[model samples]
Target: MDKRRIGEFEVSAIGLGCMSLSHAYGAPPPRDQAERVLKGALDEGYTFLDTAAVYGLGHNETLVGEVLGDRRGDYVLASKCGLSRGTERELNGHPDILKATCEESLRRLNTEVIDLYYLHRWDRRVPIEDSVGALAELVAQGKIKAIGLSEVSAPTLRRAHATHPIAALQTEYSPWTRNPEIAVLDACRELGVAFVAFSPVGRGFLAGGVRDPAKLEPGDFRSGMPRFQGEAFEANLKLLEALEALATEAACTPAQLCLAWLLQKDPIIVPIPGTARPKHMRENAGAAAVRLTDDIIRRIDEQVNETTVTGSRYAPAMQASVDTERTPAEAAA
Candidate 1:
């Protein structure tokens, strides 16, 4: 994998998201399997790992900590705070919560400092500056090496950046999820902030690996996602056919083709594709080596433009939380 600069730190261009090692995607992988996958990722040249305090309620971070153990310094550790889960999901950007969360993340991650710490979501109840100010304090104290924000609008990012330098901004950006191009991508480029793309494979949908949603286990996160449900699932599969055809022409897996498309779109963008299986991990990492030509990138963009995709990225309720600033009413109908 190639190395990319996230602020002052150099990390793998194709990072690994450890969320599936704990929860969301499906059943958690066995401890031995998860550990092996983590170790294998580092062995294969992946130097960036992403997790969060809320992912499996911190189980994911603890797993990474236990697996990586004394080798923490070998990779750039990135995690998120702000989004909290109690009776329901809550976005808490209060300074006190930020401080408390960082302390807990440090303990669970078994790291003295995090390379990059992100606010998982924008807390509507608090100003973004307040949250970012608290994160800046952590940087001053050397608890966090850099600051980042997730799922935030361009304006919100600018406000937060004014409080402190945001090293990166993470958002769902793939052929199926192109909303970031509206403003987020341009803002990141304008501000010289790196853009980390999570779900760059559309949560594995664009890979042609997911043929039937019914095969997904109960409680799988995809069960709740709009694009993976009923008619929407069938509609979206048609779009994947075009992507798969292109992948064949590129002599790469559908997943790799999706990632290659993103790489060609922006030099500052890095896609973190997660996997609990070692083979899948290696396959995803190989995408960085797949050189996409200008013609290929343009064909991809022309085929995957808004008219081709069939469903919204998130469910109606979850969509409201995205920092797009549009009212739910406007987004729904």
Candidate 2:
């Protein structure tokens, strides 16, 4: 896989997102299976790994630490703070809390200094400048090499970057989720910050993994997502047919086609698609090699997008937490 720069560090174009190992999707894989995926990612040539403190309330970071801590030198490690620990979701970007979160993350990650530390979500109650300033202190103390922000708008990104050079900005970006295109993408390029894309396969929808949401495991979080629900899913599933056909023509899996499209979209974009199965990890890594033509890219843009897709990315309460720019329709809604 070709390498991309996350600030000064060069990492693989396709990174491994470690969330599914301990949280989010469903019942996590058995320890052996999870270990296989973590070890296999490095063997598959993935040079970037992303995790967060809120995932499984620190379980995810610990899992990454236990499994891959010995080989920490092999890849650039990224983790997030600001999202508070609990059974329910919450955001706490207070400087003291952020600093405290970093201390725990470092201990859990089994690292001396995290490569890229991001403020997972901006707590609206706390100014972004102050939150970023806390991160800047970590950089100064050699606790983190660089700072990042996730699920923030272009304007918020500009403000955070002004306070401190944001190494990267991450969000749920895919063919189906086009929020970043609203302005964040342009902002990253202007500021020379890497744009890290999470859920690059439409949260497994485009991967041909979940044909029927009714059959998803009982605890799988996608079962609760708007795009996976009844009417919206039915409408969205039709869009997948066109995507699957394009994948067939492109000679790649739908998941790979999605990642390849993002890779070809811009030089600074890095897609971190997560998986619990090592086979899927290898398959996602293969996407870095899948080349897409302009025609295929154009068709993908035309077929699956904010306008064509049904349902918003998040429900009202969850949506209120993020600072990302909403689509015109979403804004009006």
Candidate 3:
């Protein structure tokens, strides 16, 4: 596996987005199986593992702590704050709340210091400096090694970076969803901050596994997402046909094709595509070896550009948490 720098740490190019095994995709995987997959990822040379306190109300972090706590030195660990778990979940980026959340995350993660700590969302009520300042205090106190911002716009990123150097800006970026290109990507490049691509598989749609959105269980997180509902899903499924052919030509699975495409886009971009099965872990990790030629990439992107993906990446309520990003047409305007 190849390594890239995210702040002070150099981790594997392909990382593990550990949210699915416990939180977002559907029902949580059996504890034993989930543990095996988490451990298997580290053994497979995936040195970057990402989790957040908001995921499963901290269940994901606890699981990772139990499974990988003993092997903490083996990988780079990143977690998030700014999302509260009180009577109702809310974005709270106040300095005091951030401090309390960091302590809680440390206990749940069973770690002395987190390698990368992020403000999961910019709390509208608090200034970016206050949130980032709190993170800087953590860095000074030996609580976290680096700072990251998720779903933030370029101007918000600048404000936070000015408070303290941000290590990375994480958000959704994939072949089907290319919103980061409008401004976020360029902002990170200019500021020398790494861009972490979460949900690089389009929330598992690009992997060809989501054949029917209607089949998703009641509590499934994806069920609430705009893209996974009604006609939008059916339309998105048709778009996959183009990618399927390209993946076939590349001798890779659609999931790996998606990872490889993101990998080839920029050296600073690190994708954390996760799964419940260890076998799938091997396949996702193998994307590092699957090569895509310039022409193949051009053809694949052309197909993506021609196909219009319907539905917002998140529901309207969730979309409010993101700081700054624009549609391609909006950016042009």
Candidate that would win on lDDT: 2
| TM-score per candidate | 0.96, 0.98, 0.96
lDDT of 2 by residue, 1-333 (tens): 899999999999999999999888889899999999999999989999999999989899999999998999999999999996533355899999899889988999999999999999999999999999999999999999999999999999999999999999999999999999999999999999999999999888989888999999878888877889999999999999999999999999999999999999999999999999999999999999999989999999999998999988787778989899999768876
Model 3 ranges off by over 4 Å: 86-88, 328-333
Per-residue lDDT value at 273 in model 1: 94
State the local distance difference test value for candidate 3: 0.88
For residue 38, model 1's alpha carbon misses the true position, in angstroms, by 0.5
lDDT of 3 by residue, 160-256 (tens): 9999999999998998788888888999999999999998888788999889888887677788887788998888877788899899999999999
Sorted by TM-score (best first), the order is 2, 3, 1
> What lDDT tens digits, residue by residue, belong to model 1 across residues 211-293?
99999977788888877988978988888888888888889999999888888788899899998889999999999999977
- Compute the lDDT of residue 203 as modeled in candidate 3: 79
What count of clashes does model 1 give?
0
The candidate, 1 or 2, that scores higher on TM-score is: 2
Ten-residue region with minimum lDDT total, candidate 3 = 324-333
Q: After superposition, how far is residue 107 of candidate 1 from its true place, in Å?
A: 0.6
Q: What TM-score does prediction 3 earn?
A: 0.96
